[model samples]
Target: MHRPALRTLLGARALARNPARRAMPTASHYHRTSNEASTAMRQPSTNTPRPPSRTGIAARIAHQLLAPCVLALSLGTSMSSHGAGPAAAPERPPAGTDVDETRTVAQRTRAPADCLSVVLEGVTVLLDRSELSRQAHAKPTQWKTEAERMALIEGRRAAALLQAAAPAQGSSPACHPVTQTLDGDDQFVVLAHLERGAAAVLPAGATQPVPSVAIRYLGQRCGPLCGRGSIMVSIPGQPQPFMVTHWWAS
Candidate 1:
């Protein structure tokens, strides 16, 4: 009986020492499967962000380049509008060569009711190509001089038309004249033909002499090529004779 008891005790002790061996293998396998499934169900991780595409990069570069060009073009246009910069003025051809120029002048006086003075001035001229050529010959060293030469000629011709219609101060009973000078402050003819819109109003294909009657006036004749200048005249005992004031030329 003792031996049988001892054998039973030994068998229990062996079972207690090896719990893994005593536990149900099926239960352990199920627990392990549950843990593995939980691990597998975790959320996926993200990767780092990518850079811009080639097309996008190229577009950005193009925009950067275009912005400066647009700004430069706009700046150039604004500078041109004010006539302040060194940019060249537009060149116009001389009158009466390709196109005809004619002018007329009329005057009224407050001092005398019967005194009505009228004069007409006109000329037909070609652009002095020879003069222009002479100026052009010096263009390499004197571009500004050449430019001034041409401009002076044009301005002078326009001034002559104005002088021919100058009002008179009755210096004599004949030769009513209109005039101006190169100086801006000097008095010019009240009926000067260089005024704006006069070109359209002037008669075509005719040159008429300023009449000399019932008034004294000084007349300054312009050379065929008048330099920038004006003519001056006065209407006797009048407050103001200039009905119009401004400059125009073809």
Candidate 2:
């Protein structure tokens, strides 16, 4: 073989014999790989952003969820209160059973019985006793001579009896014939004139108390006597009609 060709062949054989140099990694290659990995690590992650604090994250979520719940609860409470309030109660109650139910002062003063208006002889009277007396006092009674005398006797008897029995309502009867008049629904006047002699004669003294006059209606007792405007009466029934005197006209 030629010397140059032989030399080339020998070098190729030597290069093939030392394969480690070709297989081994270079410093530059390693450095490049490291730089690429570092760049990937530095990039922003796909994961969500971190909150300023754990509590901050929780608080934000809670606020969003809680606001609607609180608002809903408040609205529900307001509706409940409105539905239960007094404006919900009824008006114009019907007559109840006759079992004498107790009532408050306001109920008694504001609402009275829805009584029937009835006529007695020539006069109209309220079915409720107090109303009848109230109307009678407003108008003067024009009685015949005999009727007048009878009225005086009746009035005297009532005064004497009340005075003798239980007194506290008045010192004297303060009785007189009817003068002024107001007819209650033009119904019956339950009350009559004052006793003639009784008005002039004061009771024996302050110690001698005048007894209250008792009037009967539907089997119920009413009044010390109806005058000045008011009556003490008993309502016998359930959801009870409040006991009261008609003091309005007076």
Candidate 3:
């Protein structure tokens, strides 16, 4: 082996033995690989959730704040609708009940009327409870002078007696006529009338109070000794035709 040839052969053998050195990674390569690895680690995994953005966070907060307000508004609407329902109608009093407060004062919008335009002797006549103050004697607003009805008189004994007065209602306009009438679907039922704050009681020998009306009998011929009676206007929560219980008449 000559000197130059020997050196060349030795170099070739060294290269072949350390073949990985020829492809050995450099400092720049290591740095670049390290940077790539760090970048990949910093990136989020596909399954991982991202932090909410400003717009998303703002939207979520707004929804939370408005939820209660929307609920409250809906509740208020429901309550108001319920509250606006119709009012209940007045119930009728029992039959054969009556009161006889027969006087008056200045009327109010809902004032009790003391007059009735009724059929007496085939003529529509006006019956009224007039003011005692007309005489200007200041008779205590209303003196309690009820008709002593121990033995209830006959309401219809005289032809002039009211057909049905036990169910008379309080008069408004202070002089409205009372009549037997009920309101149902534009149809009418005849109801008797009793003034406001009127009630009835049992007769002399009777034990318990009877739901009856005290009716007055007035007429053109039946003078001095007028007629009065007790009548039933209702029964067990049901409206009844005027029933004459006891009476006295011309």
Candidate 4:
């Protein structure tokens, strides 16, 4: 072979034997390698966290729905621990005959069997034995002559007329009349007079002789002509038909 040809062949063999200079890469190959590297970087990683599954979402919804019930139970338990429990029922009265007996006993202890009540100038005036006795002795009376007796009656009538005409002054405490009866034959009567305040009594009746008195008014307490007023009497056993003296004023 020629010397130049032999040298060219030896250089080619040397280049092939050296791996670092074996071949030069093309532009398309370099572009393809760059694209693959970029794709790998952009892909999502298996190690990264993911969004919640359907089961997890359902669990959260269930917790929200039950939260109110759990809170209410806790509050109820706390209140019970503090002694705020359900209230007790009120006591009931006895039924039938037992109830009647209890009421009778109560009445007997509180007031006299023959007691009566009176109302005057919108005020409830309670009259008992002591009150009646006081009024009877308030003014000395000696109606020895028929003329004096007649005068007394006329004066009382005039006072009643005056009281009836007078305007009500003001209000007073409430006092309701009782309806329970004493012994069947026992009775009650209320009487009013012009010169006297008022009186409550069980007058002489067919069965009973002596009067069972409750209250009596002292005669004319304040006056230029003396306090003038009408009288009202309530009859026991009946509801209405009260006996009233004619209106009068001094």
Top-lDDT structure, candidate number = 4
Ten consecutive residues with minimal summed lDDT in candidate 4?
100-109
Clashes of 2: 22
Query: Residues 85-139, candidate 4, lDDT per residue (tens digit)?
Result: 1221122221111111101000111222222343432322233333333323432
Off by over 4 Å in 3: 1-5, 18-22, 26-56, 76-250
Model 4, residue pairs in steric clash: 160-246, 160-247, 160-248, 161-246, 161-247, 161-248, 162-247, 162-248, 162-249, 163-248
Report the poorest 10 consecutive residues by lDDT, candidate 1: 193-202
lDDT per residue (tens digit) for residues 1-250 in model 3: 8999999999889989989778888999999999999999999899988889998987787667645543332221221122111211123222122332211111112222454333322222233323211211221233343221200111111112223334445544343343444122001111122222121222334333344333332112122223232323222232332332221122
TM-score for candidate 1, residues paired by index? 0.18
**What TM-score, to 2 decimals, does candidate 4 have?**
0.22
Candidate 1: where is the Cα deviation over 4 Å? 1-48, 79-250
The CA lDDT at 61 in model 1 is 78
Residue by residue across 7-94, what tens digits does model 2's lDDT show?
Answer: 9999788879997766678999999999999999899888968758988877787666645543332221221122211121121111
Look at candidate 4 and tell me the lDDT of residue 70: 36
- For each candidate, the alpha-carbon lDDT, in order, equals 0.32, 0.31, 0.32, 0.33
- TM-scores, all candidates, are 0.18, 0.21, 0.22, 0.22
- Cα deviation of 200 in candidate 1 (Å)? 14
Clashes of 3: 28
